[model samples]
Target: MTAERTRALQERFGNALMPTYGVPPVAIARGEGARVWDVDGRPYLDLIGGIAVSALGHGHPALVKAVADQTAALAHTSNLFLHEREVELAERLIALLGDPGARVFLANSGTEANEAALKLARKAAGPARPVLVATENGFHGRSLGALAVTGKESMRAPFGPYGTEVRFVPHGDAGALRAAVDDTVAAVIVEPVQGEAGVVPAPDGYLAAVREICDAAGAAFVLDEIQSGIGRTGHWFAHQAQGVRPDVLTLAKGLGGGLPIGACVGFGRYATAFAKGDHGSTFGGNPVAAAAALAVLDTVENEDLLGSAARTGAALAEGMRATGHPLVAGVRGTGLWLALVLTAERAAEVQARAADHGFLINAVAPDALRLAPPLTLTPEQAASFTGALPAILDEVNP
Candidate 1:
């Protein structure tokens, strides 16, 4: 059945589908908790969490109920009329961040949220402020506005002439950030933890320094928490761990559990920059999506998932490190977010071997394997991964 589905999918889709993603492998059918079953009924323990999007795992009762209830009530009313779920979700998010007055602009993905943030920053700065500063290895999104500010050349090269007035500063270098974000700059965007860059974290005082610099220069401080927010880092937002507040905060990824949703949150004076009708989305803040997100938030709070993530993540890291296998380089990250660096140049081989052993992980880079399991993961499941790691390393390293 699995082979038949794969064949049929390939034949029907063919080259008709965009080649952006590589050839597909197994066809996933259903999921529950941190486990997913393929068409062949093979179960794989998911550690990537759909690339950090599934906060409550596959099918949580609360999320299922919220989505069903809201859809039955009012799935979408268009941005023309305000909806109750949207208002409630916005209020919940604002209260979660301890910023009651923060205004929110909802979208469908992380990139769109970032696009809204960029526009809001530009509008706040007016026409005089032209330059926007971002960090090296920092990823915002794929839209032209977000892409223009992303630091990776490989991701940006295809779409040249994205726009004028954008600068890149070295990540974790506060002095370089200060020098780049001058009065002419409209905003300085950063990711508290560079998720795509092998789980690299910013240096101590980096965020605070950026906050100070942006405050001094009157530039908007925008933190793209798409991957690091929604309790991935054991915090509602990773920037909170640094004790810094950004003027513009973009969130998505895990926001909707498994559903699609995004938001650009503006604080203090920046919240008032976007006047009526300045920006909007047809599907943004759909009642169903908001309900899904609200369900995720409520589940996290009720389950004490944040504290569980921190405790389990630390144990997993410690267990992996205690292996002391020569092939194991180190472990770096916080909460449920982590990466296993390998001394061998065979991260891909390790991932394949792990799959053969009924585990799922991601080789985010050639030498780095990333793990972002669902916040609701059991301690036993986490320990199972760590126990199997040494053998996986042996198979690859041998």
Candidate 2:
């Protein structure tokens, strides 16, 4: 009977919603902790974590309270007036970045944060620098401005020319980055861990090398940490672990603990790139989102979820590796973010099998299954998924 409800909702979804995302098989009804229940009333362990956005997991009390209280108090003030929560959030993010002198511009999503970064870089470069360097296969956002820097050809093909010269180079090749960024370059944008490219991480010292190259070429170093930031990689920001600082940092995914909030932060001189009335957002740093973000930050610190994420992620990676299944090649990524690499391109089949067994994982690539469970995921919860893996793999048609 509940399955009929799921089917009915899906049918309605197909008719009402745009075809951009296609029809998902399961219709989620509600969630708590690291598990969610579909409309069919079937519980599934959530390993996807809303694509690494649910830092504290579903129905987290701190997040719930913050959002509730803030909404009840003052939801939207438009950008016309300033609010305390927004200022506090910006200050907290700058503190987390370890640069007290930095400045922040909040937006509604990662793409918008990145768009702000692009505008800052362009404004900084002015007419002298006309080129932007980005790594190949890098996924920033689908918006036209962010899409221009995004490395995927297929996604950018539909939009045609984006009125910007984006020079694409091989991922993790510092030499190529150096060759691309010269006096004519405005900025170089890259992700420490390329989340969409099957959770591929940059080689050791690659980010620091980019920083050096950008400094030498007088180009801004922009780090897109939308997926790898907010303790997903066991660090406040992935760049922090590398001991490399960026001129601009774009963040969103887990910043607000599932609330829609993104920030583009500028450090030192980059902070002054925008003059008065340079850029603004209508609902960017609304009080509710800022309050939600504060709660997430406070919870991460108070609960020591950063330590929890590191420990649980290690256990999950180790368990997956120890399974010794033939189809299982290896695991990639760090902290709570991970990807199970398969020997063959059968991730979709495995994902379906996993779903059948009351688990939810993402087939990020043909041969890669992404696992980004919440920071609150316990050892037992992780073990359950790992224990079920061999059986799930065995059932797949070879």
Candidate 3:
């Protein structure tokens, strides 16, 4: 009966929804902690965490209460007036950035936040500098402005003529980056960890090199931490570990604990770049989202989830390596954001097999299964996944 219900729901979804994401195999009904239930009431251990957006997991009391309380009091202010939640959220973000002078522009998603940062870069560049430098295979967002600086060819191919002139360089090649940025460059945008390009991380001192180049070239150093930020990397922000700061930073994904929210922050003088009426969002920083974000932040600190993420992630990686499965090549990434690298391009098969075994993982690439599980994932839950992994891989390979 449940299978029939799931099939009927899938049919309805296919009939009603657009084909942007194709048809999902399972229709999720609800979730809690690191697991979710499908419409058929079947449970699956959720490791992707809604693409790293569900920081506190589904139905977290703090997030739920914050949203409910804020919605009851106030929901939308439209940026026409000031609201305390928005102000508080911005202040909290600046504090987390360790830059008291930084200013934030809240948006609904990473794409919109990137758009704002790109605009700030253009303004900072003025007319003399019009070129933007970005890393090859970097995925920023789908919007035209964000896509202009995004270095992925296939994503940018369909939408040509993305007005701004952009120079793409190798992801971690400092020499290539230095050669690309010159007097004509406005900003250099990159991700600390290239999440979309198969969970790859920047080499040591790479961010510092970018900072030095940007400083010499008088270009804004923009870090897009949409996926790597908000304690996903065991640090409040990924750049904190690098000992370098960016002139502008974009954040989203885990900030709102499943609510839609994003922020584009400008540091020092760049903080005042917008001036009067430069940019705005209708539902950006709605009270409920702000409250949800604040709750997430509070929970992170009170529960010390940063430490938890580090410990669990290390143990999980070690266990996967100990499995010594021939299909398993290695594990990459830090904290809860990881990719199980496989020897062959059987990630899709492995992902399907894992799902059949009551686990939900993302086949981010042909050979990489990305894990962006909730920070609340318990050690036992992680161990269960690791324990089941060998059998899953064997079922796929054998």
List TM-scores for all candidates, in order.
0.97, 0.99, 0.98
In model 2, pairs of residues that clash are none
CA lDDT, every model vs. true structure: 0.89, 0.93, 0.92
Which of the two, 1 or 3, has more TM-score?
A: 3
Could you tell which candidate, 2 or 3, scores higher by lDDT? 2
Cα miss at 6, model 3 (Å)?
1.9
Ranked by lDDT, top first: 2, 3, 1
What digit string (tens of lDDT, one per residue) describes model 2 on residues 1-398? Answer: 33898999999999999999999977999999999999889999999999999999999999999999999989999989999999999999988888888999999999999999999999988999989999999999999999998899989999978999999998999999888888999999999989998999889999999999998999999999999999998888889899999999999989988899999999878898999899999999989999999999999999998899899999999999999999999999999999999999999999999999999999999999999988999999999999999999999844
Clashes of 2: 0
Local lDDT at 113 for model 1: 98
**Which candidate has the top score in lDDT?**
2
Alpha carbon lDDT at 95, candidate 1 = 96
lDDT of 3 by residue, 201-231 (tens): 9899999999999999999999999999999
Expressed as tens digits, the lDDT of each residue in 240-301 for candidate 1 is 88999999999998999989999999999889999988899999999999999999999999
Clashes of 1: 0
Sliding window of 10 residues with minimal summed lDDT for model 2:
1-10
What's the distance in Å from true for residue 264, model 1?
A: 0.6
